[model samples]
Target: MEIKTKKFKRDLLNWYKNNKRDYSWRETNDPWKILLLETISQQTQLDRADTYFKLFIKEFPNPETMASSSLKKVLILWSGLGYNNRAKRLYESSKILCETGFDELYPNFEVLPGVGPYTNNAILSFAYHKKVITRDVNVDRVFSRYFGVDEVKTFIHNNKKTLLDRVSSRDLNQAIMDFGSMVCKSKNPLCSSCVLENNCKKYIVKIKRPQEAFSGSNRELRGDLLKLLLSNNKLSLKKIEKALAVDREKLLKATTTLEKDGLITIKKNNLVEINS
Candidate 1:
């Protein structure tokens, strides 16, 4: 299916003008805040991401404050967010930004810890308002469905100039993300109401995958362990195992993984604590 690039862009931007999501992150062009929001939103729901973003921006406000603080402090605020490594990376990246400066890091954001291609482009589009497309799952779904192609990167590369011409990258990216989430959702998409319905090539309902059970999962165990350590300064291995009601081996494996992720420290004295 050949997409009318100009018409598609017009329809997309027009739909966005009426239906775009109003996020606090969208209100500013501050690169630091944008980076923080992008990092927090990764693999996290928008609502929960916003909650954490508020907490983080309130406490840190800027890279300098976060860089000056200890990792343990950041982890405490980031406790319930899961994927605790994100907080650590944010802390590490903040230090780098503080030392090297944001301007110097322009277009090379991947050098920062945990900032991948999507995030790097996201920062450029959202913060710098550069002509770059962020191909996250949401953006990918929208484009893939519209073009009836799995190779979204190739499609974007071919149509980059036309898609972004005379359009604000920030608005265009945010519009696509919002449209995907609201209209072209993975399950139960509202195709009848979608503005691009007529032009959509593969307007089919996506199969929803069953969510993994969180109960009895390693993820739950890891969260429990972190909660325990967050309340106390440190805990003995035996104490953690007993408290979590897990076997010694399971506890050790979880701790090893967490320690490897730089989220916690297993001291020589058989004590575990959030990494400093």
Candidate 2:
């Protein structure tokens, strides 16, 4: 029996081969570099991330070197890129991977903290050309609209392998990522221009709402705080709470979120940056 996802995979792959962006990660085979780009791009856009990625390579050329680095330098380089924790996690992951005692690049994502499935596949596809499925917000929307998935976490964590097993992970990841960026965008979805429109869940369901359903997001706030502290160098919890104008709990939540995400380190004197 033919699999139920054949048409979905076919349409997506066809669309992908014909209409894809010339992204920076596509040009390299370095796992460490791919990992860096993946880390920097978390909750951040590609345009902003590309700039830092280049700078990151210049600053920390190797895994072992980056593992032995400091957060002030990382935060300085991370600069405009937000969710500073991503940079911290990148640094920590580098250290973790380095501690494994392998001299070359560490491509495995399962053991890497601060890394999710999306990032794992990014390294595999862009760095190793391995068939991997990627699902950022874009891919998730593509999944939600097409596969009757309204809950983001469900599809990413539970239903991903089910859908992706029918397609090449690399192609599926690339396809949906491009589909979201180019055709299935936030405001106006170019449905007519999209190749997978026929099989698109959103198109089939006749729904037009973007992933705005997943709004009230913490990304922008996190970015703002990181940039502020990186520039100002040590902000009191009170100072940050006032400047941001958020409730104490919200501010505290953001801080904890960032810390857990590996963006900053707290000490007796101040909240210090751990990644750039």
Residue 43 error, candidate 1, Å: 1.6
Clashes of each: 0, 15
Task: State residue 171's C-alpha deviation in candidate 1, in Å.
Answer: 0.9
- Model 1 residue 127 CA deviation in Å: 1.8
Q: What are the models' TM-scores?
A: 0.94, 0.68
Model 1's number of clashes is 0
Show model 2 residue runs off by greater than 4 Å.
1-4, 101-108, 128-130, 147-168, 201-276
lDDT (10s digit) by residue, model 2, range 121-165: 787776666655665767767776666567756645654455566
Q: Quote the positional error of residue 35 for candidate 1 in Å.
A: 0.8
lDDT of 2 at 233: 68
lDDT of 1 by residue, 1-276 (tens): 224777777898899888877778886878899889989898788988999999999999999999999988998898888878888899999999988977899989999999999988988887788999989878888887887877889989989998888888888888888888888887767888888888888634355677678888788888889888888879999998888899998898889999999888899999998777
Candidate 2 lowest-lDDT run of ten: 207-216
